[model samples]
Target chain A: MQQSNAPWRTPALIIVAGCLIALLTFGVRAGFGLFLEPMSQDQGWGREVFAFAIALQNLLWGLGQPFAGALADRYGSGRVLALGGLFYGLGVWLMAHAATPWQLQLSAGVLVGLGLAGASFAIALAAMSRAVSEERRSWVLGIGTAAGSLGQFLMVPLGQAFLAAYGWSTALTLLGCGVLLVIPLAGVLKGRAVAGGATSATTREQTLGEALREASGHGGYWYLTSGFFVCGFHVAFIATHLPAYLVDNGIAASTAAWALALVGLFNVIGSYSAGVLGGRYSKKYLLSSLYLTRAVVIAVFVLAPLSTVSVYLFAAAMGLLWLSTVPLTSGLVAQIFGPRYMATLFGIVFLSHQLGAFLGVWLGGYLFDNTGSYALVWWISVALGITSAILHWPIDERRVPRLANAAP
Target chain B: MTGHRHAALLLLAVLAAWSLLLGLALWQLRLNDEQAGKVVVLFPPAWDAQTHFERTLRAGGLVVGQAPLANLWVVYSEQAGFVGRLKDQGAWIAFQPAPFAIVTLGGCFSGPGALPPSFLKTRRLSGDRP
Candidate 1:
């Protein structure tokens, strides 16, 4: 039965807990790149070696997201998150001292990927979604997404300073400590997620199998997934390679850090605005326009002369576009399938996103190694942005008939 | 109602603590101690020039370590007369005196080791532009 513990313990605690998890997990993940040059130099390996490991991590994260949600669905997100935190801490700790490339792959790549799956924004966002009122869902989702931006803004410099002060191994161990903070936050999210919102009291709970079947058959769902993949590609490629690109081009390392921080800082606004806007407008159109704008922005950035001014401008512009898609994409999934199976459906969609992330990060390194440049990747991002722009245009945003008929 | 209020309050307190931790972490990152009087001395760009350039540093005083950039040596204790001798010997030096800047960038990558403060800055590397 769907029951609320009370108002105090209800949505408020859930939101705070969810947001904190988003901040910690996302924040810790964002700062890993600061260790790249230092780590590779010490290990006597190429940049692609480190890049490939992180790319594998993203691939594993994508592969694990759906299963993590499934586990959360079956056994409750609390236990799953606890398990995730454990793995995350262990993976980071192991990564800190990994002496061999294979070990680095296992710890940073495989284990961290699995850990992220369990502790990702999906679990927290899904928990909050189930707890909040339907009318307030998009607003709450935006807040959660913004917290992720906050994490990136705050953690990057700290990670850099830590890398500078304590060395990369000790600095990474500190990040491991930071991620462990999520484990306790998971406990507060205890209790089963009720399929709240528009579903009536008499509506029967949909089986996981039924939801999967419905989503696979829906053309719009496929479109949404494919569009989301582009988001992952753009975000991952930049996160992994942008700093190195700037540094390689004779720009100060601080500017690269500032650029990333600016992205995180502005994404707070972008994500929140998208959330607020989704409630009043067509999410599909908004998504389409956002993608189109990304294509234009990337084209302009690449064509323009590269300078410190250009870099900061690009960061701020991209920041506004970055992660804004999260609330909308997840909200669309919720709207289409109803909030009942949101974590699972969205997780599957997120899988596609991670797949794109894997390609983006991997190809950034692979191509850079072969060609001695990131030029090809930049144009590829522009091309993917256009494809996603068109793909998101045709998504049918109307609620599925089952949910519509069942609602009051 | 009381239980709900207590839960909300508790959660708010947790949030406050988390914010404090993040603020503290950022504060910690800003607390870098300047590596006083450190400098990256650039040897002439030619590949064959590196060995002789290293020899000049050894003859000048003491080469602290081999830098990442080719023909760059991290030298310690800038001797006033000795710097002139190195300059006369055909070496360009970037004097990083005090209160050096640290920049932090984000990438979702892995960690390996620590780099010296001198290599972290680009403008100090080679005088390409302003």
Candidate 2:
């Protein structure tokens, strides 16, 4: 890796700060599901409206990620992260006061979406990847992913407690304040992707256009992107609708809240394990296996009788698979293409993920409103998981010729 | 040495911030328990407006208003044990709406064209309760 000579720019500092940023950003985003019920009930709107807004948020996050990543590549992640934090905080603050669907779309969907693109895990992971050696890179990425899960675990309960005490509006306002902490930590992660013509041990000087074209031409990249779409779909669907589904089935609201928290908590172990294992195994195979396992877990949860025990069991089982794809998929991008433009390239992949998220969340609400049940969405999730497993199995894990030739 | 010290300081600061947030959330939740009178009443999905009205009246509570959800309503009563009465009358779930009043969002009960006079009366009654 290209090491900075500055005393404070140690790899440890970058990794620590980057992990914290990922934690805050992902943690805050994960808690949005807790608001869907209250917001929908208050507005007298169908689930579709809030789902559409959140779906739009995912779409915009995906749409803006490349631009955000490119800017982070050209300038530095710190500025992008700080700007994103401001927009994110404002978006949440505005979402609290949104009286109409359009206002909700603008604040929660557009502003927060764009803000997430700039301050998301993709940016933080890219910076962290460049800070470490290749041997330790995947493990570091896992740690960052784990931190994000930890945030979800901590923040969801906190958000629930806040909602219980202060109400939804005050809860969101307080959460917005929590997101602003990202700005001050941004200072530690200041440096462009190519500092003095080197990044992540690569000295190749490729322009932005070349990087995009090269990646676009690779079949594996497309496969990887498509597979990631399923990941997004499964995540957003469950996060948004699972609590409602449980409530409809006669579970207490507090149990539903704890169920989501359990998903986050268990994911901490799952993500870290996936990261450590990715370093020693085939990333493609690991990803393939993870998707296949997701299908089975969902199938069992839906087929079995609904009880608090089943719900908690399902949460724990699914938690192990949740967000576990992140480290391995990101590792593949860094491995195959080189980490020089990882923020931009991985941002594209993440865009696919967010697009899937958009569809999953929106479709869940639309389907439920029409049929009065989420059964079809669960079946669709199962089918997509199997297909994703197939899509990933054929990906060639080899580096492109350029990266191969440049390797010492 | 300096890098190690800087990293340690950052860790400490982050931990402190998180601890403070957790403490605040817990404390507020505790305080909310003391001021819980107004409750959110949920009925079965098939329940209609008349059913919600009949049920609330049966439970000896005034209907504050309905939320966006067809089966969910904001019910207010100064009568103690009113929540238990709601459960006795087939309410799916009745819990304190303390800080989560659905009507306060303005979409449901804000403008003059919004809720009825009875809703306004009910709101006035429950205003100081929670």
Candidate 3:
């Protein structure tokens, strides 16, 4: 049964706000790749400089997530989200004015990264998960992920138009202002997790340290963490590099832009389906299958001839698997450990994902600069995908003893 | 269940709105294609007026107009492959001017309501004649 500790903080309201937050935060970040070409060209810097800043941004975002989740788990999501929005908006706004590499790193890398940690859809998922009953949690997580993908679908073109019309500086400033919209939405997402609701509550309140210790000892948690790393690597690499790769292969810039957007478009369907299916099936198995599918998809895309049609096809196929892992992976966390410290535990799992992202983005730039192709990195992604698929196969999906004992 | 239904309704509404916006953008692009020989050129933000002017001339284009934003210019050229030339000369993006300018300027000013007067001025300046 769903318990309402705060009648005002209805599940509907939380879901809505969480969805919007996911839209703004993920949408803005997804379009960062659009900046890479123009911004690097304008600054007379190599792709590595811009890539390093973005990689650092991912690293910082991943690093800050657990702490931000801890804070959200402890105090409330509202304050964390508000502060994050401010940082995010300010970071992007400053990034527009950053002339030097160091300045870019400070603004785009540090501030925006931290902003994402707090304001990202993960926090929203956690909040939304706590709002609904156990049966609905997976589906809600899917809704949030799908909304974020929709943001990507919507924002990429808008970002491209902004870049095409106003230039990168004004476009970035506009996006910065857009991120500030998160602050108001955060208000409705206020309140920590309900003390004893559905599968989330323990008979006795567990300390954060104990929660951390318990999660660390769980082998399934480590497997989930390791598997998520591949998701981060694949997504970050493709989102950051695919536009350039497509353009390099004789596709028009406009087509390339739309191809990236198409990924986001298809992702909405994939994420929602994953969410809906995750509720009905074993999340671990779903995760395993999603990874295996990614490996095969990437292998096929790479082996196929590059054309406008192939690019769009690859994007649509890849987008389906893109963030679909998010809901299932996070769902498994909520399922096994419960949603009590989901924000924190998921944050740690997300950290591995970010580490993969950092490597993916940085390595893509470095390899391209040295080898003049993204071919090597593409194969690495495929290998990692296969490895992650294998890792998730043996995970135990049952609820932890503590939560199982507390369950009615 | 009611909450879930409401959330689903909202999600559907969002997807619908996004699809609508995409349709509008594609329609605008098609409309923009009907008018040719004019391209919006985006230069680096750090570039000055002299650089933009010289670059446009170098790319075989005549400077037709400028947007409020510093680095975006409206250029006209009778020469073939004008957009390609602009790309060669380091223009970040070269595209049909109206769709991008109108959408961006409209966005900057909030909406179509605040758009007309500024847009009219831009149109006059952007014209091959004026």
Candidate 4:
């Protein structure tokens, strides 16, 4: 019996690297909401002021992702992470000392958003996916996602503690420093092949514009993009406003923070489980189920008794459904189009997600100011979730036209 | 034939296991019928100028009556006016109807004419003086 060389080792290493990258990127982003109230109170700014900044951060993050992903795909993930770390550090420092709303917008919103785009799992997972075998791709993606969820869990509580002791500005500065830790991990991502083997069949490489046109022409891409938009809206709205909502409802701020943390912790399990399941089941059905579950969970939570227990329950339920979409969504993109320009294509899809995020975060603040209730925002989330569930139902998850023709 | 049948049986077993797991998780989740308790509710005192501003309080499956006259107090901050008054010192509607249940909602209220019948209830009760 011939001993097979440990072929699995490379994939395992790539998964670990992906997980660490995810942890640093999302941990900081998840903790951003914790600063909303404290920073606003200190600066005498309205919730909308900070909300707008975070909304911009989300938008720019979406905008920056494809470019970052392309750069990493072309050059390697090392340089991207290094550059992102610098920007992230600078952004956090500026946020710490920000006196004006515009400064907050620039530092926290634009800079951090772009920094995260460069550093996040979108790029990291693409790199990992390319490095691993097709059989392990979904599992690797899941591990990467679960790492980000773990970051959310760790960072939210840490942010809460920082707010308690050192204040928001100082806490932000320290958190920024923590993001810089990713710089070292980026070294491990060096020297991998940029394009997956499947992507190289076409003689003529499509330019970004041509790629966009090709993707746009495909009905599945639009469905993916539109459904992803709801995911963004639901996540960004809740992340930005739920703490404030809890505070308004007379719940203790710490309890609200814990609610957010619990979401992250449970999502760790949910995302990993979803990834495992995606391997065996139809990815589309799994995605549809996730969205529908989100709608049902949100509707039931809002209608149920509001208490610490309910808050945690809601958080856990929602968390499990949260970002469980990422692995499946990105997995489908790869499944449909191959991983040649996976980063760039996924970035465009993510742009739609960010657009929804922009609306969700901004609209939450706007509506709150106008109506003094989050009822409308909650209902919109439910509607969007249901819509997303339906949108993903009919997507033909087959290889792209060009790829199909070229294959032997 | 044997290999194909074995593969099919394996697939069925996996599916069955997943179904059982999902069903068990769903069954464990308790569905509560009670609606979320409002910790605080804000309304203009003018809305209750005539009638007694009644509010019910509930905690731990126990329902208790609260006399609006005794429990509900009209708070007037100097910072507010006819419109600003409610804006400044709006009524506190307790969602949890308990001491520890945190306040959840705060806002101002405005309407036409004098204070409502509920607001006048306190005055009427005070008016029956000898």
Better of 1 and 2 by DockQ: 1
DockQ for candidate 4 = 0.02
Q: 2 or 4: which has the higher DockQ?
A: 2
lDDT of 2 by residue, A1-408 (tens): 443435778888788888899888877776676687778789887766876777677777788999999998777888898888888888999999988999998998888888888888888898888888777888888888877777766665467668777788999998898788788877778777653333433444687789899999999899999999999889878866676677666665556656766777788788878888988899999999999999988998888887899989998888889888999999999888877788899999988887787688679879877777788999999999999999999998898887776565
TM-score of 1: 0.76
Number of clashes found in candidate 1: 3
For residues B30-73, write the lDDT of model 2, one tens digit per residue: 31222225677778888778988898899888998655467978
The 10 consecutive residues of candidate 1 chain B with the worst lDDT sum are B107-116
Question: Which tens-of-lDDT digit does each residue in A137-171 have in candidate 1?
Answer: 78778777877766666665566556655678998
The top-ranked prediction according to lDDT is: 3
lDDT of 4 by residue, A6-83 (tens): 354354455566677787677667667557666778889987798788767766787898898777655666678778
Any runs in candidate 1 off by more than 4 Å, and if so which?
Answer: A1-8, A37-52, A97-102, A196-203, A243-254, A365-376, B1-35, B39-130
TM-score of chain A of each: 0.90, 0.89, 0.90, 0.86
| Candidate with the larger TM-score of 2 and 4 | 2
Quick one: ranking by lDDT, best first?
Answer: 3, 2, 1, 4
lDDT of each: 0.72, 0.76, 0.77, 0.65
Model 3, C-alpha of A230: deviation from truth (Å): 1.1
Candidate 4 per-residue lDDT over residues B40-101, each given as its tens digit = 23344555532323322112221223322343333221221222222223433322222221
TM for every model, in the order presented, reads 0.76, 0.75, 0.76, 0.68
Q: Please write out the lDDT profile of model 3 over residues B19-49, one tens digit for every residue.
A: 7755544444431322338877789999998
Better of 1 and 4 by TM-score: 1
The lowest-lDDT stretch of 10 consecutive residues in candidate 3 chain A is A195-204
